[model samples]
Structures are given as structure tokens and as C-alpha cells.
Target: MATTFPQHPSTRLLRDLTHSLPMALLRTREAVVQRFRTVLSRHGLTEQQWRILRALDGRDGLEVSLLAEQCRILLPSMTGILKRMESRGLVRRDANQADGRSTLVRLTEASQTLLEQIKPEVVEVYKEIERILGKRKLEQLYALLEELEAGLLEGQS
Candidate 1:
């Protein structure tokens, strides 16, 4: 026979894991990403690949580490992503002239052309989001998100 501790409200550790900020954000992201997945799939691109390509679209050449940072992708993971994209003729990497140890990545002509072709579809998707949220609310949402990010970053220091 074993004795068990009595449960009490004071002893409760968390309200609910489902209500966690990270999980909530992830759920919202998944919802938004689902809406874009079809368009990406039709273009024969993975979400990560698309992000990398979009990050490099207008830029001439960005350092691999900087590109990964801007795209919020891990460096090791980006290496594989770039390899696949390079094989597809969507991107190319060149050694940084200033630093032989560092590499820079840039979009290829094919990807640039593809981006131009897909602009309308992507814009349509953005319009649909605006339609759903309304312009004012969308603007508010962006402001609120930026505020939250700034607040959190500020708190870190």
C-alpha cells in the first residue's frame, strides 16, 4: 500500500499546454500556411524552398548565414535546401570574394521568372487574407504582432 499526495488548486502547475503562447502561434501559422500550401505545391516548391527563394528574389547576393538568418532557417537545414534548389536551377551559391570561407546565395534567372509569373497568384492570396480580415484589421494585426515581438525582445534585455 502506498500513500498519495492530495490534489489541490495550489499544486496545479499549468493551466493548459494547449493554451501556450508558442502552441497558439504555431496553430495560427499552420492555419495561414495551409492556405498558401496549394499555391506553393502547384509551383512545385516546398514552403522552405519558397521562403529561401523569396528572400533572395530582389537581392543580388546575400551571405549564406545572413540569408538563413533572414529566412529564419537553420544553417545546416539551409545547406540541404540550397542544394535541392541549386539542382533545380532555382538558386546558385558562390564563394564570397571578401571571405573565402563564407558563401553567398542568389536566385537564378529561372526563379526570378517564376516569381514574376506567380506574383498574381500570391497577390490574390494576400487579397483573400485582407478580404477576410479587412484592411483596418489587417493593419492592426500587423501592428499588434510587431509590438508583441518588440516587447518580447525588449524584455530579453
Candidate 2:
């Protein structure tokens, strides 16, 4: 008689040996984004809009391509975001002086003021999450995520 083995690992073995890190990460990201979305909702801002605002907020003025790179968004999506932000008076876009073909993006005074007002609330959200996760775990999580991002981005490059 011949002995046969199962094609897949046993459920107990899978549960014990394999960590659902990816799924856990996805859920955590979704939860955090949802919380941030709630904050943005008060100001009628979408997630993409917030991302663009933060990118422009960090660097007063940037080219569309640079904004796209910072936000990790596609060019077309960034174009639409700019249009919406422009309409809402949150951002201004002009032809780059050095290169007319390139568009420059900047946060308008209104957008800057809005960002300043919301900065505390944003920080509060992060603080709350850190408190929940505890400082040590949060730091560890940040380190691990940074490593993962660096690896993935390096591979892309």
C-alpha cells in the first residue's frame, strides 16, 4: 500500500505558520483611509483631493508630473484632481515659466488656510491611531511598511 498526502497544508498548519499580513495591512489601510475620509468630508474633499492638497502643501509649487509622483497617482487622474481643485479655489495651475508645455501647480491662499485649519485634526487622527496601536507597535509598523514600500518601489524602478 502507498501513503498519500494532501495537496494543501492542513487548516491548523496554515493558520499557525502563515500570517495574514497582507490582508491585515489592507484592512488597516482601509480603516485609516476611511477615518481620514470622514475628516475630509467635513470640508467636501475627496481622498484624491486631500492627497493632492497634502503634496502641494508640502511643496508650495510643483509641476503636474512632480505632483503625480508625490501623490503616486496617474497623470490623467492628477489632471482631473487639478481641475476640481482649481474650480473649488483650492489650487492654481499655470504654465511653467521655464517650460510652457509643463503645468505648474500650487495651493491657493484658501487652500493653505484650509490646510492649516485641518492640520490639527489630521494630527489628532494619527495620534489617536498611534495611541490605539501603542507607540512601539506603531513605530515598528512604520518601519516595516517603509521597508515594504522601498522594496516594491525599487522593483518598479
Candidate 3:
């Protein structure tokens, strides 16, 4: 026996209403992430590596634990990123000045130079995204996303 999908017009609309929002959001996120990854890759960076670099750029030195938190990455994964970055001379990891047990990661001069080179392109991409969405819609999107993120964090806790 063969199964039939719903043929009723109302059923189609209901299905779309129920599925389109999440599907569209996920597709949009995937597209944007792909673009971001492409940009980072050109600079010899992974998404996680970029996150670590960006964090350290804003604050030159940070504990690995704190960097992991800021990057929203697991400690093990962050350790891997740091190791690779360190090997490439993009970052330096040393015992925390005040705490021998904790490691502090800092960007190297090479990493800072790379960031300076890429900063303009990064800003241009951001501007393009905002232009595509329009300022008002972008603000609304940010608000909606912040609420969603907060709800997710609350649920996790």
C-alpha cells in the first residue's frame, strides 16, 4: 500500500507555517556560516581559531578557560585550536603570570598583523550583511536572536 501526502490546501498552509520558520532560519545560518568560513580559510584559520583570535584581539591576554567560554567552545576543542595556532606562531600560550596552574593565551605579532590586514574585509562583509537586511530589520533580527539565545541558555541551566 502507498501512503498519500495531504492534498488539502489548509493542510499545506499549516505545514508551511509549522516548518518554514525553522527551516529558513537554519538555511540562512548555514549560508552565512559558509561565507564566514570562506573568509577565515583564506587567512589560514578555522571558525574556532578565528573565534579565539578575535577574542584575544579584543583582550591581548586571556586564560584558556575564559577564552573557551568567550568562544562558546568546549575546552578540549579549544585546546586543539590553541595548539595549532601556537604551532603556526599565531598565538603564544604561557603559564598565567599570576597563576602557574592556568595557561594564558596571547596573540603573536604575526597574528596581530594578519588581523590588521583582514579587518577591513571583515567589516565589509558585516556591512554587506547589514545592507542586505536593512538597518531596522537587522536590529529586529538581533533582538529576536538575543531573546532566543537567552532562552536557550536559561533552558540549559
- Give the candidate number with the greatest lDDT: 1
Q: Candidate 2: which stretches are off by over 4 Å?
A: 1-19, 155-157
Judged by whole-model lDDT over C-alpha atoms, candidate 2 comes out at 0.88
lDDT of 2 by residue, 1-157 (tens): 9999776755655543235777777887899999899899998899889888898886758999988998889998888878988999999998899999998999999999999988898999999999899999999989988999999999997
Instruction: Give per-residue lDDT, candidate 2, residue 5.
Output: 77
* Tens digit per residue, CA lDDT, model 3, 32-119: 8887887888998888888888899968599999999999999988888788899999999989879999999999999999989888
lDDT of each: 0.90, 0.88, 0.88
Scored by lDDT, model 1 comes in at: 0.90
TM-score, one value per model? 0.88, 0.83, 0.83
Ranking by lDDT: 1, 2, 3
- Lowest lDDT 10-residue stretch of candidate 2: 9-18
Between candidates 1 and 2, the one scoring higher on lDDT is: 1
- Between candidates 1 and 2, the one scoring higher on TM-score is 1
Candidate 3 — which residues are off by over 4 angstroms?
1-22, 155-157
